[model samples]
Target: MPDDARDLDAEVRYAASPDVAWVEGPDRVALVDLRDPASATPQLCPEPAASLWRAVAEGPKGESQLVALANDVVGEQAEALVAAFLEALAGAGLVVAT
Candidate 1:
């Protein structure tokens, strides 16, 4: 989902597709496919979410601006949700923090 197109909160709340992949068992971590409206999984769970974290860690944007961006479409819980999603990815070895 593009940030500019739809409200994150609204998208998560109403527009998200019903399909999500749970990749676990053989690996310690898991991969979840957050399907887009087009049904293509463009994000690789933690890696992309890690990129988001890198963006935050770099301090490129003020917390307010960043949080607003996180909240832009994701609402208040977006912060934690992104983190949990990333952690799940990391646990599966799909992504590693640099």
Candidate 2:
């Protein structure tokens, strides 16, 4: 894992970015960064990603809690799944460290 991933795993708490506009659909969730016009095009998230998004959106949650939540959705893949999701959300400015 990269240093950032390791640091995230070490106890970073995260929550959905206030700048993100969220819309939930029947099968997927759409996210757009209100602060970034380039991201006016929504990013549609499916399945586990949507689940993780909803969880973080509710409130700040630590890495372990997120991994456990992912475990409920993806079994043994929880750790990697969470890491990837967090990285993607952070990169997209859809999630922020709290």
Candidate 3:
């Protein structure tokens, strides 16, 4: 793993809150949050976010493992990107960090 994959926090898992629902389209996946009826943040994730979510779909995963997986799929800079995506997912209550 690259140095950028270091200093990661706890493991995270895909956690779908009741407030949000997952929607899968022909070409992409999306999340619909019921918290705000009018405003919807696009859940159409790119690259490692989609892959990372798939990784943790079965269970929780450490940041390092996730980064490694993303790195394998998306190549360079995947660690930083996956970390950031995980943070956003956690913040949105779509994932749980433990």
lDDT of each: 0.42, 0.88, 0.67
How do the residues 1-98 of candidate 1 rate in per-residue lDDT, one tens digit apiece? Answer: 77754453333211112243334233132334453535544343343344444443343333344445566546786677555644554454333433
* Candidate 1 backbone overlaps, count: 4
lDDT of 3 at 88: 86
Using TM-score, rank the candidates from best to worst. Answer: 2, 3, 1
Pick the lDDT winner: 2
Task: Give the least accurate 10-residue stretch of model 3, judged by summed lDDT.
Answer: 7-16
Candidate 1: global Cα-lDDT?
0.42
* Residues 1-98 of candidate 3: C-alpha lDDT, one tens digit per residue: 65544444333434445566666655456767777868977577554477776666546677777878878877898888777977787777777654
Q: TM-score of the candidate numbered 2?
A: 0.84
Q: Give me candidate 1's TM-score against the actual structure.
A: 0.31
Give per-candidate clash totals: 4, 0, 0
lDDT of 2 at 65: 88
Please list the Cα RMSD from the true structure of every candidate, rounded to 1 decimal place.
13.6, 5.7, 5.4
Model 2 per-residue lDDT at 60? 89
* C-alpha lDDT of residue 29 in model 3: 60
Each model's TM-score? 0.31, 0.84, 0.64
